[model samples]
Target: MARLLYELCGIEDALRFSPFCWRIRYALAHKGLEAETRPWRFTEKEALAFARHDKVPVLVDGDEVVTDSYNIMRYLDHHYPEAPLLGEGMAETRARFFNHYAERTLAPAILRIIMKDLLCAIHPADRAYFRRNREKRLGCTLEAFHAPAQGLDQLNAALEPLRGQLKTSPFLDGQAPAGADYLLFGHFMWARCASNADLLAESDPVHDWHARMLDLHGGLGRNARRIRDVGAV
Candidate 1:
């Protein structure tokens, strides 16, 4: 059987927007491996019951089932060692840090800016579930929680460390893209695919790096369908 990847999508099946799923998608491309991607949505918990995970991305690799984006990356590297992604020694440790940073800091910041737009993009069947769950976690309604102006400021400030790193190198992992690159790139991809929010300024080095990432692995990110034009960086 072919490797199957369950990924989160929006209203249209083609609109694969989840940051975690994007990480695995890029990881698979980096390994030069292909998997048939299956679109999953917020209300489709039953579809993923076999994986025993509430969230994506779920990777079905023969008899091995992998959940979580970071684990999926590790699994790919372990199984396909020809092109190492997590790097070696201290580099691996740094990638781990990037993974955490993406989940904790970057994802939240972007979500604040694009949550409203995201709601519009997701499947109609998922809106209620998405809103209920998100509002409960956020302690406010989606409209009250979304603050693009504040979100933009927070996002830029939170990106200072990454901005400093990009000043010296083109990618998070020095000259070439790696796990660290994908970790953060997935967040940006989240905003790109779901919202028209202009998250990055043209002068920002991070914007340039994002463009580079989109062009990587045969334009895997660049070619993906988005809800609307995210506007120029």
Candidate 2:
């Protein structure tokens, strides 16, 4: 059996905002890597505890600790060569690229739409602490994100070629959902958190496919105790 000591992450991240971590978690789940998740909330110092390079996605495999989301995904791909994250043909290749682009570029737009100022109405403490900290670290105030994000046009343009693929195929890669699905899933999930639940709720096949990914994984996500338990930490 593959050991359950796979990866670790932060909790409030999904809401507090960290697209990178969410991408890694979904990658792990999609591959069925059965890793232990250690969730660390970053209201303060916890974010740095496992960061080898001062980041959140610190993958702990037994005594080994790997940081960097891309590196983590690479490690999983290398270790579990079966059920490849990259699918088989040109279409699959395109889907993988689409996933990466959508996750990387379109993410900010989705976040801007989600984390809007309706915040003071709910989870004020968490919101306040996150804003203060991200500002200190990124060198900008939370208000920076308030400017009606400017990348959806780019996102829509990027996803244009695949708009047809998504409409025709049930999954991003057609019959089988590949690693790409999880990547995009993380984006949509984060959008939901940031409050743009309407994006996916719109007439997009991505929403239906995301629901299927959840079913394949057997739950909302790899919130395996190791990860979800960190909610309190």
Candidate 3:
């Protein structure tokens, strides 16, 4: 049986916008594996009941079912040892640090920039649930976070370290792209597919790196559907 990957999508099935899901998508490509994409939506909890998980990025590989993007990456590396996601030597250790940085630093910053846009990108069936839960997490209404200039400024500031790193190396792991690169690029993919917010400036190293990333895996990301075209970089 062919492998299957269930990922979060918006109004269009092609608009797969989950940051975590995007990580695994690129990881799968890096490993030279092609899984059928199952476009899942925000209100599709019941659809995932078979996995006993309410989240997307669920992978079905033959008899094995995997939940969580990080775990799925580990699964791919473990099963397909030829193409590695985590780099060799001490690179895995360094990549772990970048992974943590993406989770602890970059994701939240990007969320602030695209929170409102995200809500609109989702299916009408999911709007109420999405707003209620996200608003609860922020302790304020979704509108408060929508296009906040301060939030965009914070996002640019948060990306400074990445810009500095890219200045010295082509990829996050120096010479080659690693798990860390995929992990962070997923967030940018989220912004790209869900919103038209100009999150990157032309001269920014991060922007250049993102362009290179989009070109990888045969333009898997660059060709994705953008639900809205409110702004451009």
Candidate 3, residues 10-69: lDDT per residue as tens digits?
777777789899999899999889899898987889999999999989999999999988
For every candidate in turn, the CA RMSD to the true structure comes to 2.7, 5.7, 2.7
For candidate 1, lDDT tens digit of each residue in 42-102?
Answer: 8889999998989999999999999989889888988998778896688787789999999
Candidate 2 residue lDDT tens string, 1-233 = 32332222223433333456666766776776666554444443555565445555667766666776656666777777677675446745665565667656666566555545324312444566667765786477666765543545444554555467678787776788766666666666555443433554356555566567656666644232222223433
Per-residue lDDT value at 106 in model 3: 80
Clashes of each: 0, 5, 0
Off by over 4 Å in 1: 229-233
lDDT pick, better of 1 and 2: 1
Instruction: Write down the lDDT of every candidate, Cα atoms only.
Output: 0.89, 0.56, 0.84
Ranking by TM-score: 1, 3, 2
Q: How does candidate 1 fare on TM-score?
A: 0.95
Total residue pair clashes for candidate 1? 0
| Candidate 3 C-alpha error for residue 122, in Å | 0.6
Better of 1 and 3 by TM-score: 1
